[model samples]
Target chain A: MSKQKAVLSEEQIKTRRGRSVALAVTLGVLVAMFYVITIVKLGPGIMDRPL
Target chain B: MTMLEQTQGLHEDATDLGGRGSVSDYIALLKPRVMSLVVFTAAVGLVMAPGNQHPILSFISILCIAIGGGASGALNMWWDADIDAVMSRTKKRPIPAGKITRQEAFAFGMVLSFGSVLTLGLVANWVAAGLLAFTIFFYVVIYTMWLKRSTPQNIVIGGAAGALPPMVGWAAVTGDVTLVSIALFMITFTWTPPHFWALALVKNGDYQAAGVPMLPVVAGETATRHQIVLYSLLLLPVGMAPYFLGFASVFYGVGSAVLGLVFLGYAIRVWRVREGDAAKKTAMSLFKFSLFYLMLIFAGLLAENMIGLV
Candidate 1:
């Protein structure tokens, strides 16, 4: 959540963008890891299903 | 945030006023440095186990163990924020520095604890998950809250939590612990006193002010140094246990012996040199070398396993 603040300077805006990018990248990597593990663990049974 | 702003924020937090923090602050609550060590030791246990484990399950199990370790750190920070604020070494922690609120830190830790434990149980076996749960409980409740300030032997007993990762990792793969894993646990368990007492000797003033009963604070520095030397002596054999047990090769055996000797030498320096500046320097030297000693021993085990595979 954004804190209440005055108008940002150019440097402040750049720093904010950097922080957001880092957070997004980290979360994305974690999500992708879980996704790969989920597919690898469960996909084979579903692929060979008869029902 | 600026220092002035952070100070104001901490003051507000102390008075039950409101403040805000960022994702990095939340992450810092997990103590990533300690988490890395836990993850490494746990991964070593899993990989070296002579049992089959699916790659996906092993990854998940290790990840869950790391998260559990991180959760313990967060819970520890939450409970010890008071002492942390007073201690120079820990005053800049996320909570005390006003980067995170106490309630938020505690909530974050609780969520991670339950999530990691339950997910590990579902993905791996209940045995591994149960060990993770116990490790967290031991670190948070048994070590951080109960024993930390109550007794001088706090780190001695609290070391169990730090030492559990390997057992958890081994159990994840084999679904049962073996003597090898127990030996790994013991190495870390005994290694704790010297590793921590070295730092305790340096930070006696902080422990004194925080009212934490560190061995140096309660037993005096000379006594603490004697204990460090004793523990270092014990560590020499324990460090070589993997090779002696035939799990690791002779390369590890030789490396561990040299490293253990160096470790003992540092502790001996701390014990023998009892002057003013010289004593502090030796204590700090032992403190720094202890980190390297632990890292190298574990790395030696990993390398031996890899060489065997080759």
Candidate 2:
């Protein structure tokens, strides 16, 4: 037997899209924040360390 | 099926399939107004701390503190949805208004709480993270779940959670709690009762209907008014502690004194006016003035520190 898919209405689609965008923006900001913090914490000698 | 029946079925199915809330609804769950006060106070604390901190780290610390504060608000809303539904002021909140489920709020709160605390620990220090975790737990478990429904002294104890952000911010910088930070904590702690009790006086009926046991509901309006006066009096010296402790300049000292006096004047009006619209107006005036009083007090500290007047 095949299963049917649920179709979303316009309002539902808008809400889902808004939430997706918000989540994406929030995650992107978090990533950027972490990167900046890492660079700040490590200081100018960050890349000078031995492998 | 008839045309009307077919349309109704489609409508129902659409509603059921649709997402329950928008991004603004989720933001509403965070109590952004309360979060703003948290950010301001925490930023003051971070700036007032003794050590020199990187600007980027300080910004991250304030952001984490704000997110933690917002998480606590979401958790509080989850626990208080029932009472929130009954209260006129809170009936339109996300959970009570059916824009979000309690389980979803709980999950959102938990995620933000953990994420914020973990990030602060990694970027700042564990002391700040530990305080943030404790603050979330205190507000959610101790205040919302336990004290709020149980006693008239609910906000009195719960105020500690609201008062902890400055200490958390200070800890983020110094990695230790100190006397100056404790002074900031004391000012907010003492200010909470009068600030909240003023509103509680006006919203006594809402608390009574919601069965929340606010001071006005449990101990009567006159008693609550007296408590407001008492707390306002206590706020005077507590607000000036930074100046007395030699961390703030004489200007901050004088400003805090003047603000505290004005706060007391408002509280006196609340105590003197005892009936009808005048009474409510007086109480509301005190409530509004209380917010101004706190902002000025913290702003004075921030200004003093920034101008190197401390």
TM-score of chain A of 2: 0.85
lDDT of 1 by residue, A1-51 (tens): 989856666755665676688769967976887777677667778577677
In order, the TM-score of chain B in each prediction is 0.93, 0.94
- Assess candidate 1 and give its lDDT: 0.85
TM-score of each: 0.87, 0.94
Superposed model 1: Cα runs more than 4 Å off? A1-34, A48-51, B1-19
Compared with the true structure, what per-residue lDDT tens digits does model 1 show for residues B1-310?
5333334334434555323456667778889999999999998899898877788779889989999999999999888887788788899898888667788788889999998998788777899899999999999999999999899999999999999999999988888878999999998998999989988888888888777889988989888988999999999999999889888877788889999999999989999998788888888999899888888888778776767731
CA displacement after TM-score superposition, residue B111 of candidate 2 (Å): 0.6
Assign candidate 1 its CAPRI class. incorrect
Model 2 ranges off by over 4 Å: B1-18
Worst 10 residues of 1 chain B by lDDT: B2-11
